[model samples]
Every structure is written in C-alpha cells, then in structure tokens.
Target: MTTTAGSRLRALLADGELITAPGVFDGLSAALVARTGFKAGYLTGAGVAVAGYGLPDIGLLTQTEMTERARVVVEALGDVPLIADADTGYGAPMNVVRTLRAYEKAGVAAIQLEDQAFPKKCGHLPDKELISADEFTVKLTAALDARTDPDLLVIARTDARAPLGIDEAIDRANHYAEVGADVIFVEAPENLDEIERIARSVQAPLLINMVQGGLTPDTAPDKLAALGYRIAIHPGALLAPYVLHGLDALGRLGGTMPDVTAGPQGLFELVGLREWSAVGERYRDNTKDGA
Candidate 1:
C-alpha cells in the first residue's frame, strides 16, 4: 500500500526535528513549496481568505470552500504533506465531525481547529472570543473520532491568551492534549517569556505561529526548537512579500519593475509545461508511427 500523506507527516513529527511549513494558499504557491523541497506545506486560512476570496480571515470562508481549495493545493503539492487550518470547525461538535471528514477527504495531512467562537477573527487580531474549555474539548474529541485515517493529525489551538490570559491558554492547551490532540498550539504568545512558558507547560508536541508583524514576537526557528517547539508555521512568509512586491511593481509600472520579458510561456513553465508537453509529444509520435 502507498504511504498516505498523513503517515508521512506523522513520521516527520516523530523524527525529533523542527518542521517548518510555509503558507500556501493557491496551487502556484503549493507547487513552489513542493519544488523548493520543504518537508511540509500549510494551507493557511488567512492566506486563502486574502488571496482567494479577497476578504479577511474573519470566518468569511466556509468549510466546503476551504476544502475545495485544499484539494487543489494538495494536488499541486504532489507528495508533500499539507497541514490545513479549519477555523472553529465551522460550528459545534457535530459540525466539527463533518468538517473533519471533509478535510480528511481533501488529503490534508493535518487539520488545525481553534477554540475561538463562531465568526472568528485572525489569532493576531483583537476582540477574539473563545468557547469554554469544556465545550471545545467536546468538539475536538468529536473531530478525533471522525477521522477515517489514524495518521491524520488533529492540532488543537487556543486563543485564550489574548482574551483571558496565558495561564488560561496553557491550561486549555494541556487539556486538549489530554483529550488526544496530536499537537498543541497556544496562539499568539505576546513575548519571549510567554512563549517559553508555553513550551514548558504544554505536554504534547507544540506548534508556534510565526506571523509577520503580528502579536507574537518573531523568533528564529532554531530558537523555537531550543525552546522545545516541534513545528513553526510562517503563514505570511510568502503572501506578505508577494503583496509588497506587487505593490512595488505597480508603483514602478513602466519604470523599474525589472522587465525580464518572461511572459505567458515562462509562467506556464513554472506550473509544469515541459512535463505536460513531453506527454503530448509521446502520444503524437505514437500516432504518426501508426502504433
């Protein structure tokens, strides 16, 4: 039997190394991450909302929309395991069950669900509300039971640090792990001290979000690994630069955009024109030879 992508991700986690996953919102981003040879890729909900739907990550996108995008990204990523975000599981515990099945079918190696209330905002943003720890635990347990593949990881995130306190966040993270969350993510630790506290307190393998200019002070991956973090997801590493560079190009216009003249053909090559052309040529030659 083929090794499923979820199995691959599980192996990576067990390897005793820090996995760095870059955010990939579109097929092109996924293709680039795969070609660049990353250990894994993250289908960022914020990236999808901003790039795909031209909206913010305030629970505007539905579970099905994210699932459809996840399918396309997984196809583009080929063998790379993708860790996807399914915010708040789209509703209650039963809702989490359906969301889990949908994402698992989309070939996501891992799915992240947070404790934020419905119509959730980005973790970095303020005014975020969360469901009670007990309530979220039920939703998380339901997600775990709903998965068809045992290798498919379920990451439990807590946004309580902002609204309640870091103590609440840590408590909730440990609670989620106790209920069988594969990974614990304490979202938006405000400083190095809070980050260290979370690393010391959380019992399960930990994941840290490295959002640019966000609430969490940016820490190097090596430093994070030293603090006992297992995964560092840079959700804006690509999208932020892409937007800034596009704005610069727009400002330069006909002036200083570095006119490489690499037009449609170059763009197509980035998305695998050569391999597709070879397949077409092989069929054409066989037809000419009357085989």
Candidate 2:
C-alpha cells in the first residue's frame, strides 16, 4: 500500500518548526496563501461558516459541506498540506471514522477533531459542554483507525479547559496522545501561564489556534514557538481585516454616492493588466506560429 496523507503530515510535524498555517475558507484564499509561500494551510470551520453561509460557527454547517469545502481547498493548494477542522467529528466514534476517510480521500494533510458535545459551539465561544475523556478517547481511536494512511495527522483537541479547567484539559491531552493522536490541541487556554503549562505538560506535538478578540490574548508566532508549540494557526487574521475594510469601503461609497469612474484605478493599476495583456498577445502569437 502507498504512504497515506496522514504520514506526510506527521513528517512535517516531526521537522520541529512551528508550522504557521493561516486559515483558508475558499479556493482563492488557499491559492493566495500558497502563493505567499506558506508551507501549510488550515481549513477553519469558523472561516467556512462566515464565508459560506454568513452564519456563526455554532454547528450550522454540515459534515458534507465542510468536507466539500476541504476538497476545494486541497485541490487549490495542490501539494501544500492542509489541516482541516472536523468539529466534534460531526458526531460519535463512527462519525469520526467516516470523517477521517472523507478528509483523507480529499487530500487533507490532517484532520482536527474536538471533544465538545453534540451541537458543539466554537472553542472560544461560551457555554460549551464536553464529552467525558473516555468517550472522546474512543472517537480519537476511531479516527486513527479510519485513516488509510499513517501520514494523515490526527489532531485531538480538548475544549475541557474552559468548562472543566486546565488540569483536566492536560489530562485529556495526555489521554488523546495515548490513543494515537499525532498532535494534541488544548483549546482556549485563557492566560500565558496556562499556555506554557500545557506546552510543558504535553509530550506530543501540539497545535495552537491564535484568534483575535477571542478568549486567548493575541500572541506573536515567535512567542508561541518559544513555548514549544509545533503549529500555530491564525484563522481570522486575514478574514477579519478583509471584513472590516470591505464594510468601511461600502459604507463610504454608498453614503457619499461617489461617481464610480471618478476614483483612480486600483487593482488594475496594481497588477498592470496592460502588461499582462501584452504578454498574453505574445503567447497567442507564439501558439499561432507553432512555437
């Protein structure tokens, strides 16, 4: 049998550098990130919820929709590894098995499954409930077994920190590692101390989510690396800025009713469309000449 996608991700994880995987919602965003030279990308459920349905990440999106979106992103990024968020494995142990297979076939490099209960909310969100550690362990095992490729990295995320506490979260992380999770993600560690504590406690590779205006304060990637985190995903960094800037521009244009043709050329000038068109003309001429 051929090496699996899971094994490829594990190889990247073993390299010992903090993989900066920016959250990508669509093919365009994934392509843009790959073009920017990042080695890996993350398919965030929050980004998908906001971009695809204009809804909150409150379990509104279905497993099929998320899997389909991952397929598009994986295709767009080509060989670049993608770590996809499969929230709560979309159900139970059996569900996790299916999710792993789906993501593996879609060419995702890793699949992250959280331990939140059914109809789970985002980790940063409030009023979260968690399944028992033993329950989640079974799901994690299923995820590991379901993967056809050993290289398809299985990231076990514990949302127990907020509801149960940091100690419990660490315990769950240890359990996940025992159950064959390639990486452990202890979500929503509120302070710097907890971050350092989890990094110190968890022996397996760890992944951290850096979200703006969320439970955890914003920290630099270098700072996180210093604490021993192997992967850091900033899912909302680009999306948040784009949302605010787009709204600002829309409000200004709609309120002032400015003449559309009055402003200076923007992206067209930035990209030099005329130059590109001239190059295309040359290519067309070459094709016509059979060169």
- Cα displacement (angstroms), candidate 1, residue 167, comes to 0.5
Assess every candidate by TM-score. Answer: 0.86, 0.85
**Best lDDT goes to which candidate?**
1
Count of clashes in candidate 2: 8
lDDT of 2 by residue, 1-291 (tens): 555445656777778778899999999899999899898999989888877766567676789999999999999987788999999988878888888898888999999999998777768866788888889889888998887776778899999999989999999999899888888999989989899899999989899988776777777888888888999998876677776587579878875432221111221222233454466569869999995
lDDT scores in order:
0.88, 0.82
- The candidate 1 region of ten consecutive residues with least summed lDDT is 259-268
